[model samples]
Target: MQRLDATDNAKALVRQLAETHGDLMFYQAGGCCEGTQPQCFEKGGFFPRTNDVCIGTVEGYEFWVDKDLFEYWKHAHFTLDVTDGFGAGGFSLETPLGKTFQVHYRVFAEEELEKLPPVKRNIP
Candidate 1:
């Protein structure tokens, strides 16, 4: 009953960031620049656009996805993963740390759909 999750690697990175940045949050803009990569921020730093969907959280950090994209991905689940290497052109917190936050997604099975938690929709 979840829409978002994180790999152990991602969780460890978040902890490291939190040590310096305090609480954190994330947004996947689904646009150019970051190009759909999840951007991490100090909690409450990046504001959510109207209609952004709160898919879920990891380590208490809220993770949001652009609503328009959510319409296309409504049936898919997301797992936040970190990759080794520089995040070219990405502005996420992790980008400066030689990492980029990316989403690994898959369509939910019928059984999973039924158990999925409802998304918290933002109205702006």
Candidate 2:
């Protein structure tokens, strides 16, 4: 496993979220319109992906991202900020690498994640 350095701002941001919201899982998935797929996850159980990497933990919550995906984003500079209008869920990260990548955080209900298709892969 590779070691990832979450900026002090990033660590603090994640810790705050976990403390407010019970447990948070980190993973990568398709992005919203005009957004680079980000390392995201809802609050629930998740199957491991081939390239997934568990970088470290924050406030007892595991933080991870697909190794390959993380490498792709390693060079993208990010900024963390907080906002109001959401229930302890306004944390967001902005990348200087343009809108190609989109990172988002939201309160996810357990039932909502059950509807996602199971992860599958085929190697030639």
The per-prediction CA RMSD against the true structure, in angstroms, equals: 1.2, 13.4
Q: What is the C-alpha lDDT of each candidate?
A: 0.87, 0.42
Instruction: For candidate 1, give the lDDT.
Output: 0.87
lDDT of 1 by residue, 3-116 (tens): 888999999999999999999999888676767778899988889988889999988989988998899899999999999876645667887788987889999999999998
Candidate 2 C-alpha error for residue 32, in Å: 7.7
Error of 1 at 38 (Å): 0.5
| Model 2 global lDDT (CA atoms, 0 to 1) | 0.42
lDDT for 5 (candidate 2)? 34
TM-score of each: 0.93, 0.40
**Clashes in model 2: which pairs?**
36-100, 36-101, 36-102
Task: Point out where model 1 deviates above 4 Å.
Answer: none
Number of the predicted model whose TM-score against the real structure is largest: 1
Provide the clashing-pair count of each candidate structure: 0, 3
Poorest stretch of ten by lDDT in candidate 2: 92-101
- Per-residue lDDT of 103 in model 1: 87
